[model samples]
Target: MVNLTDLLTDLAAESADVDSLVAPLSAGDWASPTPAPGWTIGHQIAHLAWTDHVALLAATDVDAFFASVTTAPDPARLVDVGAEEFLAPPDELLPRWRAGRAALAAALAAAPPGEKLPWYGTGMSPASMVTARIMETWAHGEDVADALGVTRPATARLRHVAYLGFRTLRHSFAAHGREVPTAPVRVELAAPDGATWSYGPEDAADRVTGPARDFCLLVTQRRHRADLALTATGPVADAWLDVAQAFAGPPGAGREPLSTRDTTVSEVTA
Candidate 1:
């Protein structure tokens, strides 16, 4: 069982980690493009800030959240619209994001035990909400890092992300208009610290195994499967990799693989 306190703590850490990456940036640096098509580093942070705000509403004010949803701009471009609307100057944006996330943590901590918060497509317990936030923080942080040509070290927080990915298998299939498979798929990943993290039935015929970082990248649609070292054994597992999405949304247009031919030519030229 996930402890609400623990998940909230991890959520804070994940948010802080991303904060550290953006805090020192010059205004111009915020304009750097990320792997997410058309999203700059500013858009990435703005999206996080906006999400945290709405998540706060879900946790504390149900009616307002529902109203916001009902009145929201196009569902398809809502994410992009939110990012644009919430964007601000770095100094102002940084403090707002920091304060808002802190308030969200406090709200979640005080939420009634077993209280289900309204969210897009589903309701979430406080713990589950925090876990989703962590996943988003890390995933968007990956975009920010990529924009700046920085690398982030993988940590055990990936366990939360991996767990969410595993749990969302059905959503992945359904969003893609495929039949949700009843077959259990096992996932075994090598953690950053050389430990093994396993999920699903030991006897399950479908399985995915790989580095935890790669698995997180795959499920978050941060990288193309071809660029990762994950191995999917059996048909369900193989097909799942093609459409897996950790976050709730329509099927993402995942990043394209780095072309081997282009890479070789660049290498030769250098």
Candidate 2:
């Protein structure tokens, strides 16, 4: 089982970073549309805050959480649910989100050992669940940051997101309604600071190789595989590259290739 201590700490820091970005925005700013079609900055954050609240429920009240999530519309259609329900301006909306995220983090940090939490897709241990939240936090945070025309620094926090992407390769395939190979595919990434991170077996016949940044972007669907510097040596690895997703839900409409620039954002709604 993954020890959630460090992961939770990282998650809290990531949340704070995103908060800092959105906190200074004006009411008009939150209302601005993002790279995601039909979703304003407010809608992006509202989705995070709403999911945060539900994550807290998964940690503390599993049955109640299931009931509410089941009664709500499909996750895909719920983007504007929180923004619509809160019915407040940016100042009010931001505060509620801050409170909810803080509470959710605290609850996850304190969850009992070995307890599995039910999520929209698979059941997750505390660390996996929090890591997933951090992944979304960073990914959605990217969308909001792009909408604001702001560039944020990337950190080792991306390692967790990358790990999730590698670990969830099977789920990603299944979500696409495709079967995944049982064999493991090796993943080797060059970290920004010149560290090497490896996943799967070092000697595995199938391998994915490249910078961790590009790998993270690929898994998050922020960049299309063709736009990244990744190389896959086997069929499974090659196919996985075409449809990698670190987030939950059905298959995502991953970002399309733009120019050769890696810094630009993709309009993928996933």
Candidate 3:
């Protein structure tokens, strides 16, 4: 099993790094168009901060948490919580967002081992929460980086992302009403620091081999799977390309096939 503490810590560190890069930008930069349709950089960060707040609440009170949430907030009541919180001037916004993140971290750290916290579809243990949050932060951060035309430094935590992707493979197939492959596929991922992570049966009929970061990027739709040096052999391997999800919830409407050279991000806007 993966260490939840390490996952959460890595996510917090990456969030801080992204925040630092974003903080020095001018107001106009906040509204710059990102690959995510209709969401500016400000909106992305705001959503993260808000999600951290919500997760903290769920960790504390699972029942009451779901009772309070709606598909959409009452627009007439607070149409711009994210924007208002993000634009409260840098001095105000940064500290508050950081504080919220700290609170979330604290909640996760203090939770009893094996404690299940309520989430959107199913409840998750503190361990799973770390995975979910890391995936979200990384995926959204990709959007911000894409908008800025900058590349993020690779990190070893991408193994966590790949793990999430591995878990979502079943959901991806089920969403398309296709049979989930019973034939296991071996995955050997090379981490950023030269650590090799391998999963699945060695003698399985299929295999996916590549850098861990690239595999994570592919499943998260931050980079085209074909753009990486990964090799997928056999029918099951090809099926994975048709429906791969890294995040929680239902499988996504997978993207159209792109040429091997397309590295542009293909995430759906929220």
**Best candidate according to lDDT:** 1
Q: On residues 1-270, what C-alpha lDDT tens digit does candidate 2 reach at each position? A: 666888888988998998898888888888887777667788778878877888889999999988977787755665456545654678877888889888987888888767889988678888888898889889888888878888787788889988998998998898898887798899999987789889989889999999898898889887788878999999999999987888877777877676653444345444
Which residue pairs in candidate 3 collide?
A: none
Q: Write the per-residue lDDT of candidate 3 for residues 1-270, one digit (tens) a residue.
A: 667677778988878778877898887887787665456777777777777887898999776677656634653323245444455544566677789888998899899878889876677888888888888788878878878989888887677788888777776677658898788878888889998888888888788888887788778866656566778999998779666777655555433345732334344522
- Which model scores highest in TM-score? 1
Query: All candidates' TM-scores?
Result: 0.95, 0.91, 0.85
The TM-score-based order of candidates, best leading, equals 1, 2, 3
Q: Which 10-residue span in candidate 2 carries the lowest summed lDDT?
A: 261-270
Off by over 4 Å in 3: 70-93, 253-266
Q: In terms of lDDT, which candidate is stronger, 1 or 2?
A: 1
Mark the regions of model 2 whose C-alpha exceeds 4 Å error after superposition: 73-76, 79-87, 260-270
lDDT head-to-head 1 vs 3, winner: 1
- Residue 218 displacement (Å), model 2: 1.2
Tens-place lDDT digits, model 1, residues 188-234: 99999999999999999999999999999888988779999999999
